[model samples]
Target: MKIEVNITKEPTKEPISFEIVDMSKKKYSEVKIYIPKKKGRKSVAPGDKWYVYFYWRDPETGKMNIKCKYYRGINQKKTVAEREEVAKAYQRSYQMLLEQGWNPLKNKIKNQRSSPKKQKHTLKSAIEYALAIKIRNTKESTARDYKFRSQFFLDWADVNFKSGLPLEQFKLEDFYQFMDYLELDYINKASGERLSNTSIDNTRRVISALFTELKNKRLIDTNFVKGIPKLKSEPLKNRPFTHSQLIEIKKYLEEHDPYLIQFISFLLYPILRPIEITRLKVRDLNTEDWILGVETKTEAFSYRKIITKMQPIIGQMELKGYPGSYSLFTNENKPSIWLPKQEKSKVNHFTNRFKKVKKALGYGKEYGLYSFRHTAIGDLYNSKQAEGIPEQQIIYDLMPITRHKSEAGLRNYLRNIKIALPADHSDIYTIDF
Candidate 1:
């Protein structure tokens, strides 16, 4: 926390026999000094020579911060006394900046606004920037989650402004109010229900992330969503599809929509999530052993081994000309494979088709596309058990193939199945021979 202060003579045109040189390198927590810049020497007043500079690391960015104040010194031709007064006025300006959280000793503006402010950020632009970085770094599934949450925030924030709200002037309470609006005013477009605390909290997180990045880039004055607690939320209860229901749905799809049958077949056997299934390309499937390298949520090759059951579906799909450059499951008319990072259209088409099929089957919203994966998990669990696989063994074998993060996710998937272990009661009853 030690900051050494010293004043060095400015480089002047008048040559001096001896120059005062301080050759010392030291780290500082804070430093207050004059800004050095070459001035035009056309008989300018000393008052105009008064220049103040502040340098520090930004609180949000932790990067070296720099700001300069060009105060109008007493008009050009000023006496020594006037120059002294101007110097004192600039000194006062520097002190005021220090008072407002500029820690020269630490070389960082403590509260983050002491530095020169950047251009005001529009809500849409800020969100798009963050989303671009998120999409670039993460899997499409995670990007979709961020995008999903960000939309609600933009919708809630931009209700009053058509262009976009400026993030610079936002207060901490504005975020709180945003959460309140999410709870009361915002409606879930999918379900037509008031936004839940969980959903609102998720939106809050996305905004916090946006602010964090914006502040890092010095785009915003402060981190608006920082330190806000997440609202408590109730966990969702999922209903796994039953075997009879699956059979009925399958028969319906087989008869009416061969495309959907192939699509669902890919989802059910390997128990791939909708996003992973959407990433499946025809060339990704190995014709020899059918080791379909799946692009899962966490790791691309987590589900490297395609199940023996899925091979038949792949064959059926192949027979229909699932070319190397096309997606494994496509619309009735197979579109070309979504190249590297573009999956928006693929997801949209897949979701719309799933919705239609689910509606046609008269299934509730709860039993949507993801339920196929859920049902697949249940089927795998039961079939493995029936074949005398140990409980832990079944979970182990399925974890890599299903790409579940842990045994806990697998257990959670089975929570809806109402499974009960069969125990031998003969020991307690003392069976007679």
Candidate 2:
């Protein structure tokens, strides 16, 4: 391989010129350019000659080799000092490469042995490249999630990734290490709680999706997480309020803080998830039919839930002058406005207030905001039993209203409701019909 330099002066800059040329065709796959730093020297004139060197890989043994190449301006002549400076710069570069253990002659011999190709993958470079490819095709939210997980992976894992690391190098042990980190990391933004099994499971799902993409790209031969087990989570449970408990909560809120009444009603009757109920708009309500159209976060089409019992409350909200804007729940003091928009905090505040209200009403610490939703489902289940409806029918009705993904999820919700119900009621196992 031969080293060559072609110099071109910038139109407005002094002393700094760019040297452009293909070095060893076998050493580097792409063209290389060397930009000289202006070390307080006057700019080169047109037709000046500058000396440069290029490095190439030997075809036989894949070692680096160097040769000299020179550049001359088409219309100007160069002073002896300018030529000397260029040669000195080349010498410095060559010395630096030699210090790094690159043997120019050995590379030339190595290049002769086989066709020149890009170097093999390092772990870091492969991961970076793979993530970049994923970012381009995925949603902004998905990309953000990948970026978050990748940051943690980079911090904990040792991989030589510049552009990206190869997926094939990732192991199941790495996945387990990541899970352990997540589980042991005690800091949580929400509630300042330790990392729970649920949170770790969510992280695992995202990572699994990321590796799945790498597999699809043929970057990895197998899913590195294939055999990794997830941390065990507790069974699904719902905390529901009893009938007397509900009345007491209503009385307390009505006397002390009326602002939360509408929000509570939205939760209690129609059984809307807090997120869905908060985002509801006035236009989503069908006044005559008592149906509230709920736009879920995961689904595209709007699903309707009947809140016929709350028609008067909905009418009162309209009379208060909150028209078809974004949020349905609003503070009574400012009827025209939705709940204060510090999302996560606002939800937390609501839950905390519910706990306080439950305590005041003598319901103990077990009742919570979610207790309302569970209570509604429990009510429906008991009503069905009273009306001679079978367990399957109760489950079927609860499915759409609860928006549970599977029958088992609905059943679990029901089981939790049963556990929370009053123990002394003799009709616990009896069907009235």
Candidate 3:
């Protein structure tokens, strides 16, 4: 049987008040015991379900929103009459609450505030939550890296700590122990090689970034990852290709794999990293305006001019009727739909494809796909120097093309690549003699 809960007020100028009445016909005054209809061998029971239903005005939308409160615990009563008594008690409580300005929405906030334990997050959940936020703010490749790194850490934690460790309870000492594990004990399952200092540091950086986000969200008291120092990484192994090596590689790519050469052009001309090139959409290119839109890791979008050298290559693409959503580079090295899951694989595909070219040319690990961009930047820097441009002016001019935000960053990159070297040191030796 259905129960009615009517809350009415006095007939005076003030709202008439009545705690309880029979008004089940009115939509807002219905409390009911729900029973599922028997189907096949299943039996229906009185205590199967119970609900208190009413209407409350939504503060934000100014619309009447239906609110429901379910009390399955009422079924704990032994008999039908006892369950009905408990249900009636619950209805009176709900009626009392509604009369005192208790909103289902607002009461939720009140309960959360009154009970801080509801906000507690376990170590695994905290990272998962942080990752959910991080993925939205970063590129797909970067998000993949974050997810892989975060999962690796979680797997490590599963082995070391008891399951479901609360985030706040994870101490700085625990983080240091994890770092030690990465440096000393961690092994690559695919290759069976121990993690290098650089690899360990990379893990640390990703975890630190995730923890930083967790702290900003107040999920944790502190980012213990920051307390641990970075391990000493190995020396830079990837160097820019020499001028002669560049010509050789280009010639090899053009002769053997012409499609791959176009990928190189985008990297060199736009100074895009391999992963960034994977992010390009067909619509990002504007042939008439001679501009290419690049979604960089740091910025949402940036424009790069399509220079005269790049114009011919863009024309060769023949990008006329292809959908704007199509990827500029794909498996066949042409424009097509690039699925989000396929973005990282496409990068690895191009990289592995380039490795074949590298093998054909007898190139070492130091020289790979990124060498094209590095070589182009070095050539540009040297070309400006040959024009007798000032070092400061050259840095200022290179900033936009290189997509470096500051002159110092560009200078640091040039210095690291050893492009800004002393010219004709023999003059100094002769003068000293």
Candidate 4:
């Protein structure tokens, strides 16, 4: 038995048209039956009828056995086009199968419908995904910190977990043990010292955030990181640079390194963190507005200080790097290592340089890199008072410059910094009214 399906198309000048012809040699005309209309579907194309007929040979009788035979028109359906396509495909296969002397229907048929692929809910993939999300949302230095912590989580899971199974199986006990391991057992490989309570707390915090993100995604039953408390640590003592010390440092840097002058000057006028200073790009400076922008760490602007005269300094800086092209600090190929490879590397590359320069000029280590900012703020506060400006107004003026998030923190900056105001004689002339 053999069957052939011939397809012809209309000419390009004519409307879309297809003609299918069943040029089949074998026909089970006796067993052929009409395929019925599918219920609740649109009627098939006008006057189009369908028929099916199948047969296989039996070994014992040496006779052909009929499997199924159908012939009919189906009602119109949204998929009438798809139905027509399947029919054409069946017709195309008929002659090919006959030539091969095999019938698929005579044996076990292959299922054409496929099942959907599943997503992995395993712990390792989820942590990596969450870490990626973390890195995207934060700055480069912050991303590095997250990556370091993520390694700890992975190493612990590899050793302690059962092939590091899915998050759904992660329990509260697992969270507790991991946190305890960081606090009590873990040691810094480079420093050869135990982690501080504060560091342990921060590690716990990042891990907790990891679980929280997974929980929100419905990947876990709960965050599994609760009841952990932050460590209570003492704030380090920070002091300001004095007027004479500032004069000395400037005079030395002007003769020694001209680039250091502009860089250090930006830190003083803007009163920004060292990291924030290093992250500044050429585009962040606006000479027209006399404002320098702090884009990441803070959203405030630093108006060029009147006493230091920052606008001229910024103009000179623009000439060094193409505007909107590179960092304010360097036009070199790569960014400066503001976030040094390790925290201690900062001691040699950053603090020691400042420390060495200052100490050579007869200043102690007490006048640190941040002292420049503290000194500027202290001077601004004192200068305003010396100019007879009110206390509340001075605080209001410097709050944004210092980028203190709250009033209490601002008060802490003002404490222990003495500013002598001239005796107020205006009150003596006022009546008791």
- Candidate topping lDDT: 3
By lDDT, rank the candidates, best first: 3, 1, 4, 2
* Count of residue pairs whose backbone atoms collide, per candidate: 9, 43, 5, 14
Candidate 1 regions exceeding 4 Å error are 1-133, 139-148, 151-173, 188-192, 211-238, 300-303, 319-322, 333-342, 382-394, 408-433
2 against 4, candidate with superior lDDT = 4
lDDT of candidate 2 over 1-433, digit per residue (tens): 5767767666675675666445544453222323343465433455333444566565555665534343422112233332333344334444434444455555542342132123233455444445544554333344556667765566556532322444454577656766766788546677787766766776677666666765665556677665567777763333566677677777888898776787878777777777666666767777766667775656644757565587767666654445666455543333345534234444565676666776676666555677777787788777767776667777787787777889998887676566323223466666766
Model 3 C-alpha lDDT per residue in residues 1-433, reported as the tens digit of each score? 3555566756678876554433333334444444334564212265355444566655455455666665635555433334444455455555544554455764663463354344656787677656655654345456568778888989988998733798888878888888888878878799998987878888888989889888777666678787777776543555788878878987987789989878989888888988889889999998889998997778878888999999998888889999999989988667998664335677898999999998999988877777788878988988888787888888888888888888878887887777565444464564552
Q: Give residue 96's error in model 1 in angstroms.
A: 26
**Which numbered prediction scores highest in TM-score against the true structure?**
3
Model 3's alpha-carbon lDDT is 0.73
C-alpha lDDT of residue 300 in model 4: 35
Predicted structure 4: lDDT: 0.58
Model 3 CA lDDT for position 246: 76
Give the better candidate number (2 or 3) by lDDT.
3
Cα-based TM-score, every candidate: 0.58, 0.58, 0.70, 0.54
lDDT over C-alpha atoms for residue 26 of model 2? 45
Model 1, 242-269: lDDT tens digits are: 8788888888877777687777777777
Model 2, residue 356: C-alpha shift (Å): 4.6
- Model 3 TM-score is 0.70
Candidate 3 stretches greater than 4 Å from native: 1-118, 235-237, 321-323, 425-433
Model 2 gets an lDDT of 0.58
Q: Tell me which residue pairs clash in candidate 3.
A: 8-18, 9-16, 9-17, 10-16, 10-17
